[model samples]
Target: MALWIEAESVERRSNATEDDLQAIIRAVYRQVLGNAHVLDSQRLTNVESQFRNGDITVRNFVRAVAQSDLYRSRCFETSSPYRFIELNFKHLLGRAPQDQAEIAEHVQIYHQYGYEAEINSYIDSDEYIRSFGEHLVPSARGNRTQSGIKNVSFNRSFTLMRGFAANDVGKSAKLISDIGGNLPTKIVAPSGASGVYSNTGKRFRVAVSQVSYGPRVTQSVTTFEVGYSQLSQKIQNIQKTGGKILRVTEVA
Candidate 1:
């Protein structure tokens, strides 16, 4: 079982062969498109040609794919503002936003500068250069802890990843409420052979605060312990009851 799904890094070698170029093309689609199945018609042949002919660096090729209409329609137009920003971080930078400020900054940029600038901002970032360089493809760095990356980012990034087989067609932001409310995101391990679940049979405690409606309003706090499979539904139930989740901590 794999704990995380990583985009295979494909670098343009000085003496790269035709096979290498094809691999790079595949890698670009797999990474930038979030494992979405790309029909022949959906592929950027012109961009691939430029990459093959040594006309553009891998960075430029990544930028082109991200800017393409395919990416725009599937990811941007149909998604919420938060979802779009979230996908941009995952697809372009290979991670999740570190904090609310990062998400807010990108949202502000999109509101002011427009879509092209939003895409350009990630590609043109110093972090992008340092992490991926000009030739290497961007990959998920969520599973590994790195200096300067927040401890919470690992769980958040894994949330964005969902699972190895899951595509990025989901329209809602997975981390929006967590990031916006400054809440700690509980790491839910994915199911199946591709997903690693260390705490398979373990349980977690969900602390929630609920307000009762009546002539005299009263607030009550409660805690519920549930298995991994029941965690999501339990949270949904809490939200449906107009409850605010205060915290989710693993049971020892």
Candidate 2:
């Protein structure tokens, strides 16, 4: 529910102490790329140095991580341009886009300006500065005012560490585009739970184990089955925001 810097992490990221600044940088790497250990040490250090020197804002620091070859090979290569754009929103802007209009807008940016420029566009936006300054991180806040299924708030840190973006905008768009001449084909059932038949809405579980919510809270693990279609939609929303899908099946 907290934005980029939760009250606790904000303390460290916004402080005057050198140790705190270093911790801030570490958190940036850990949050942005999903894991700090996987980053090349030199690149991580360089990014930290850039931020410390005031040469780059927090947005720029994040963009650097997402652009790194490591991230590209792992997260972006196979991703649809929409998924790519959505991750930028989750990781750099800290929210799901307002609608399909926004997604198309970013897809245009990616196609026109290319990857680095597309990333820089989000970080350099006025919204970025308004929501979080040079010292904070991006985390999903949900489109709570929107009608239908979009009005959901995500646990911020939980989204940042997600594995990969899974939104199907690109696939959906392709499906729509190709719907005309060739007869629309039936969606082949997935072998297990991958692709369109991917585990969607029928499953919902909150990460009560993460301390990102701070010590003031108490929670027991909870689980629910949302059914495939509904869970699928929610999962797509989660994917758009750089979140992970952790399956917690209930025991009899």
Candidate 3:
């Protein structure tokens, strides 16, 4: 007779704290804007004075800031906060908010929780606020800044354990028959061993070494090689082997 039992349980983790979200937002702003303090004091004062002198209005100041290097660097061209309030809301929520009311509500929530104060401090810092008023409007085209480029190429390799089988045959013929027939079966590596080269112009190759196998059997060295045309193929090879691909190591 045999007995068996089964059970299952589920657990949920806490969501990210508001502070964590705000920190990420601040980092993104910094990466885009560069150091805001670099803006010249004289330039900011001139812009401010222009507004006071009725040479340019407050709306012009906003427009000037919006088109300046500070804004272009901090704001994404398509999905930045300046383009849409919803995008800013999404940065905070980890997803886009549904409507203007939702955007306003979350912004308020962040403010109530003191997250906005931290955000305001970053925005008001010499690095951010001053950058806004430093430069004048260009005549024809928008200023472009360099971003999101990678230089080095790297490769990833992987191996998988497909499956295994074992047979034990004692001296007794009847015992062997009871277990299974003959034992000299072929052993195959787990399906799919794969590798990848991200960034063009680099080739990737995979070499598989048989780690260890057989009962009480020493003196074993097994090796094989397979090249992949695409990353998906590499993943497939590893999956077939029931083995994991190793981290990509760069080779130039």
lDDT against the true structure, per candidate, is 0.82, 0.50, 0.29
Q: Which 10 residues in a row give candidate 1 its minimum summed lDDT?
A: 193-202
lDDT by residue for model 1 (1-252), tens? 565656566788999999988998898888889989999998999999999999999999999999999999989998877779899999999899977689879978999999999999999999899889999988898777876888899889988886557688656666654664457777765567655434436677888888988999999999888875566557657765778878777688
Which runs of model 2 end up more than 4 angstroms from their true locations? 1-15, 35-42, 143-252
lDDT tens digits, residue span 149-235, model 3:
111000000100111111111111111110111112222233344221122233344333233447854433332232222433443
Candidate ranking under TM-score, highest first, comes to 1, 2, 3
lDDT of 1: 0.82
Which residue pairs clash within candidate 1?
Answer: none
Specify the highest-lDDT model's number: 1
Residue 250 of model 3, lDDT score: 23
TM-score of each: 0.76, 0.53, 0.20
Runs of candidate 3 with Cα error greater than 4 angstroms are 1-38, 41-46, 77-252
lDDT, residue 136, model 3: 22
Q: Tens digits of per-residue lDDT for model 2 on 108-187?
A: 78788887777778878887776676667664444233233243223221232222333322221222111111122233
Candidate closer to the true structure by lDDT (higher is better), 1 or 3: 1
